[model samples]
Target: MTKFNKIVPDDFNVPMYVNGEFFILRPLSPVYSNLDYDAVIASKEILGDIFSDNWPEGINSREDNLRYILEDYQDFQDRIGFSYIILDDEESICIGCVYIFPSLYEGSDVAIYYWFNVKFAGTYLTVKIENFIRSWVVEFWGIKKPAYPGRDIPWSEWLTRPRKKFTD
Candidate 1:
């Protein structure tokens, strides 16, 4: 397994343009629980056939979502790397979240998982959000390159369950 870099507060909020709107990024916290879940579920509904199949479930309840966030925070603290919350300034709400994990196979590689709500599903917004997400990764993770060429998975091809491991 790849050792995770301990995530510490950098004392600054990351910025991104979400469909011409500006959003501030902060470390995922207990307060982000409901917003994260609602946004993701909303995205799943709105995006319809344009969503990730590997998205984890069980976020329909606030209590359950809180537990999930806490676990994720602990995981990040323990070495899962960085996870962040995207907050809307005008509306004062969180509309999305993303998690970055160190690659177990290579120290120089990282993986990102993200979800946004349906309210932000317009094509322009989608492109902006993707740009925002990747930019944050590049800046925070100390990646010298924009993205690992020839190693990124296509969104369409990633819509299936991962291969199962078997042992006797």
Candidate 2:
């Protein structure tokens, strides 16, 4: 049996730059309400697909967005999950989000999900950020092999192997 423990930190530092000029990952909070909401609304189509079943209908509204942000903060505080806002360094714009949570997959203990603005899709920085998160999660959280549930390929086939150029 696998032993479960809280792997995420209580107070997360922000503006962690994984790909220097491309983007940075910062902890999400109520202070980011307007920016985050705008990003979500701008990327609604993409996020809808990623969060297919659970996508909120009222995500376009500031009130609903604030509630979601607050809930995310609470979840992070409660050690239930962690969420981060993705910001474009060049423009200082909120572009996307990353979420890590207890796995809902049958055999996995942890799961990771991320999304970026379509404009940033297929960029080298995307691959770098993905690799960085994978390594960071393993090293900082002590998770031997985190899983990307619902992905087209098995985690063992790609995640455990060396990083490669991301293909469509």
Give the alpha carbon lDDT tens digit for every residue of 45-105 in model 2.
Answer: 7666665355756775999999988988876767767888777785367777788876544
Candidate 1 residue 22 Cα shift, in angstroms, is 1.0
TM-score of 1: 0.65
TM-score for each model: 0.65, 0.72
CA RMSD for every model?
A: 6.1, 8.4
Cα lDDT of model 1 overall?
0.58
Backbone collisions counted per model: 1, 0
Whole-model alpha-carbon lDDT for candidate 2:
0.67
| Model 1 Cα lDDT, one tens digit per residue, 19-116 | 32566666676867777777766665543443344344555677877887887777755654556777777636766766665433332355576656
Which regions of candidate 1 fall more than 4 Å away from where they truly are?
1-21, 46-53, 105-108, 144-152, 155-168
